[model samples]
Target: MKTIKPILFFLLFFFTISCVNQKQKDQEEIKQTVKNYFNAVKANDLEKCKLLIEDSENYLGVIQGEFNFLHKNYDEINPNDVLLRNILVKDTLITFTNEKEKYVQYIIKNDKNPNNLKKPLIITFMFYKPVGYDKIFNRVILENHIGWDK
Candidate 1:
C-alpha cells in the first residue's frame, strides 16, 4: 500500500508539471506570433500580416462610435508604429482592444525552433465589441494610448 501511494503521488505530480509546461509554451507562442504580426505591420507587409490573421470576415466590429476614423477595408492593420504595441495575445486570443477594440482567432505554427526556446507559441485573429459607445462625445476620443513596456 505504501508503494502504491508513492507511485500515485508521483504520477499526479508528473501530470501537473506537464500541464503547466504546456500552458507556458502556449503563452510564449502566442506572444511570438503577436510580435511577428506587429513586426509585419511596422514594415507595411500586408501579405505577412494577412497570413497571421484569421480569414474570418468581420474580425473587427463596425466603427459607428468615435472610432469611425479607423474603419477601412483591409486585412492587415495599418496603425502607426506607436500604436502597434497596443496589440497583445492573452491566452488563445490576440486582442487589440485598447486603441480601437479588436480581436482575432489564430493558429499556432507547428514547426518548432529549439534555439528560440519559446514553444507552443499561439497565434489568433480575434474580434472585439466596444463596451460603452454611448458615453463618448462628438470629438475624437483617444483613450488608453499607452503601449506595452518592453
Candidate 2:
C-alpha cells in the first residue's frame, strides 16, 4: 500500500507539471500572435494581419474598418515602436464557450494621427478546445475608437 501511494503521488505530480507546461506554452503562442498582429499593423500589411488572426467572415468588416482609416488620416502604430513592452496583456479565467477555457486581452496605444494624437485599441483573443480533443483554436477581437479608458 505504501508503494502504491508513492506511485500514485508521482503520477499526479507528473500530470500537474504537464498541464502547467501546456498552459504556459499556450500563453506564449497567444502572446506571439498578439505581437505578430502589431507588427503587421505597423507594416501596413493587412493580408498578413488577417493570416495572423482567425480567418472568419464576421471579422472582415472590423478588420477593414480598423485599417480603412489608415489611408484616410489615422495610423495604427505609435510615433515610436509599440513592442510587446508597450502592450499590456490580461488573461481571463472565465470561459466564453467550453472546457473551463479563457481569453487573452491586450491593451495597446495607437499611433499619432494626422492631428498628432495617440489613441488606444483593445485586442482580445478567445480560444476553444474541442470536446475530447487536445487542440484549441483561437478567435481574435479588436475594438477601437470608442474612448477606451486605458
lDDT score for residue 3 of model 2? 98
| Residue 32 lDDT in candidate 1 | 56
Off by over 4 Å in 2: 68-83, 86-89, 93-101, 106-121, 130-140, 144-150
Over 1-150, each residue of candidate 1 has an lDDT whose tens digit, in order, gives 999999999999999999999656644554455566556545556455444544312332321221232223112223354334544534233356434433333323223343443333232333222332111111222222121000
Name the top lDDT candidate: 2
Pairs with steric clashes in candidate 2: 77-111
**Top candidate by TM-score:** 2
lDDT of 2 at 11: 100
Give the alpha-carbon lDDT of every model. 0.39, 0.55
Residue by residue across 23-57, what tens digits does model 2's lDDT show? 77766765666566666666778787666555545
